[model samples]
Target: MAIHPTAVVDPAAAIDASASIGPYAVVSGPAVIGADCILMPAAIVMGHTTLEAGCRVHSHAVVGDMPQDLKYHGEVSYCRIGEGSVVREGATVHRGTLAGTSTIVGKRCLLMTNSHVGHNCELSDDVILVSGSLLGGHVYVGQRAIVSGNAAVHQHVRIGELSLVGIQARITQDVPPFCITDQEGNVVAENRIGMKRAGFSLAERSELRAAFGAIYRDGIGRNAAVQYLRGAMTTDAGRRLLAFYAHDSARGSGMRLYNEANAA
Candidate 1:
């Protein structure tokens, strides 16, 4: 381990042989640093945290720190950062507040500058929280989801896989997979760009497009529409979309579709 002279690492903390601690970094007791981890200047990793292998924490970032919840009374919570993730400057990842629970950031994820991940949040693999994005406690973000700059997601909200949240959006609802939303949290369109980037086949894309139209334009109830799509569109991708539609997402209720509706 290459710990800077100015860095203060508690003797009880576990630092891997290949880890590097930069100047002014603070690694307190009960913290575990895995191999190839980098803690940059002024970074703080405390509170029963584990930085998995190959993770990089940049300047002034704080991970596994105390949660901001009022109910917290010094429970034995945990924060686990997955392998190869990078936390950028000024980001804060708070640990769980409930006993035996944990805050999790999955492998290869990117937390951009000034982002805040609240206590007990779960971020899946390859997720991206862009600069100034804030996620409230107990939020779950699925794999490959991207929350754009300055977006704020409310507590207990679920953002599904391959979703793209627009810049400055104020999200108070669950966002289904492969969908795009605007600043007002309206489901404006399909996340076509993100789907393409994830290498979805044209057939999958076509089926999803038809499903979107069937639900929003055809004015059918959500379950019936999902059943129809499950029967009519027989692809794996279609099935995944059906599963998302069928899932009980309470916040999705009362959410308006992007299309203009006429009073009948």
Candidate 2:
């Protein structure tokens, strides 16, 4: 409703009456701009994208552009920015590569300046991508996970809930929940601070720490580790961690646990 005179919003684009489009911003291709969404100066929202209520597309940021994948042949895919999410300056979020699929940024997620979410990447609620971080196509980032500045996640990798990926890290494997990774993508330790901030009790944190030790420090194989965790886990956090392992990873060999012997 507050579209700037210089903004170029397509007639077919469905913009809510409460939305504000800033100067020189472009909303095109029947994109749905939800209630109270704000397109900052020079932002671009294109393709089959949907900006849910209260979303903010910052200056020079682009959402819902065509995918970067070579497999894409202009199929009708989608990009969805969830309610209350913020895409910061110069960030780019591309649409899905496959037909009828979607790239989803969940509620309250923050994509910092110049960060890139590749085609088909799915980011869960409260996720944070620091400045210049890059997520490859089809990567799935769990809720409350933080990818530090300049980290690059390989395609199809899964970053679990409450995990912290270190700055400039190159993540090629699945990172288990409640963990923290080093620059080389090694799972170094549990995300104690993140868990503490998330309101996990002392007992829950202890249980998770024990689980990590069993899997990473004790040299237990995947089967034995799962069994040990299954019988020992008592808290909701512990169960969630077990469930993360239970799911099949896109990386065929499963996640690699931290090994002190391999550390530099």
Cα-based RMSD of the predictions, in order? 3.2, 2.4
Residue pairs in collision within model 2: none
Residue 185 CA displacement from its true place in model 1, Å: 0.5
Instruction: List runs of model 1 lying over 4 Å from the truth.
Output: 253-255, 259-264
- Candidate 2 lDDT tens digits, 109-144: 999999999999999999999999999999999999
Question: What lDDT tens digits, residue by residue, belong to model 1 across residues 1-264?
Answer: 799999999998999999999999999879999999999999999979999999999999999998999999999999999999999999999999989999999999999999999999999999999999999999999999999999999998989898888899999988877888889987777777778888999998888777766676666777687678778777787888778777777566233574523110
TM-score of 1: 0.93
Which TM-score value belongs to model 2? 0.95
Cα lDDT computed for each candidate against the true fold: 0.88, 0.91
Candidate 2: where is the Cα deviation over 4 Å?
Answer: 252-264
How close is every model to the real structure, measured as TM-score? 0.93, 0.95
